[model samples]
Target: MSLIPKSHPRAKSLLIREKLVLGFEQGLVAREGLLAHGRGEAFDYLLGEKTNKAAKQAIKAAAAQILLAKLPIISINGNIAALCPKEIINLAKISGAKVEVNLFYANEKRKKNIIKILKKNGANEILGINPNFSTTLSGLDSARRIVDKNGIFAADVVIVPLEDGDRTMALRKAGKIVITFDLNPLSRTSQTANITIIDNVIRAVELLSITCKKLSKNNKNTLEKIVKNFNNKKNLSDNIIEIRNNLTRRSRFA
Candidate 1:
């Protein structure tokens, strides 16, 4: 029942792109989300569509942060809802984090549609609809600023996939432990996050879920070490070096 062939070389990634397109037509994704997905796709191609070692370490660190947080919230946008509804739900369940819809192009109609989609995907208590239960994030001036008072606003740790730079900075300013998935290692979102997984959202979330499940059984000290040892700036720099090396080698061969 999948849109693309399972045997296709780029099947998983193509399916992700196709889903975003479908989400746009269904009003679950915005035009900006489509363009953002395309941008991520180009980076994914450079990443070889595989999770690198550093990304895996970052994923483990992210899982540790979530497991250690008193209140962890997974912030989902339209593109995330359209592409990885089930994966988000599963990550939330495994990490004991709450699922909340936080979109940049905020609107009641699209919000409701996204809520319905999340519910259908097994999310029971979706947040982000109650205007009464909202708080303003001071550093951001975009539609992404309004967050549920009990969700992102109150969370000790937050997982923000496909995040914007402003919100990532604002969230950190608000004193929340931020975990982000960004293909571009040099992006502000990636650089600002406490633990930045430089990989595709689909691959990152699944690995994160697995890591969380495994780490859940480990001692608190062990989890704490994982978080303490993660250096977001260094990780980003290393990935950028890898990208440059790849390009350099390709040019020399050509």
Candidate 2:
């Protein structure tokens, strides 16, 4: 295995177990997997990996919106695998949502691996498209997306953490309410989502879990208000411009 870069800051939570398990699926690939993982890590770092005021508010609002769903699915990606597995499962459970593995690289092999990893990390009730016992998602099954028949059509709301653009677009076209966490804020995935959290996955999941636990029937209207105010394209454009201008202003020092 290639050595960790010298410039990398050691993450307190990503222990040897996390690294060993995650290193392969992420490190094993070139453009397809690891690249996305690394970029997400950067976004996580930028957001300080903590639930700030804005994030908590978003989380509460998101929870209220999510609770309104008849068939809510919590979609996980590779970056999610590398960051917060239990948190994702826990949040979904608390919110009365279903946990399903979804990735850009759709396959049984990767899907199974994701399941195995999540289960090892205290995850139960992991859902899949193919309920067949033998099919592995990351390794065994080609595309283990058993949640929806076609692109989240059956879903009223889909909580997609660290999503891919293609799937997000397809879900939108299917008219599903798509909520996601995105660091870049300018990517198509962010632009197309119903609610976009401009923060790190670790922090985003933490807040989401907290919000769901504190949520109740009484707070439904509050959540509706927050969600009602959310517009993906507007939020994406605003954050993207802010990030770009920040980068440009800093370029003078370089």
Top TM-score model: 1
Model 2 TM-score, 2 decimals:
0.75
- What is every candidate's alpha-carbon RMSD to the true fold? 1.5, 5.4
Worst 10 residues of 2 by lDDT: 133-142
TM-score of each: 0.95, 0.75
Off by over 4 Å in 2: 1-21, 25-31, 42-57, 129-153, 241-254
**Residue pairs in candidate 1 whose N, alpha carbon or C atoms collide under 3 angstroms:** none
The local distance difference test score of model 1 is 0.89
Cα lDDT, all candidates = 0.89, 0.65
Query: Stretches of candidate 1 above 4 Å error?
Result: 1-3
**Best lDDT goes to which candidate?**
1
Candidate 1 local lDDT, 71-148, one digit each (tens): 999998999989889999999999899988888998888998899899999998987788899888888888888999
Model 1: lowest-lDDT 10 consecutive positions: 1-10
After TM-score superposition, the amount by which residue 179's alpha carbon in candidate 1 deviates from its true location, in angstroms, is 0.4
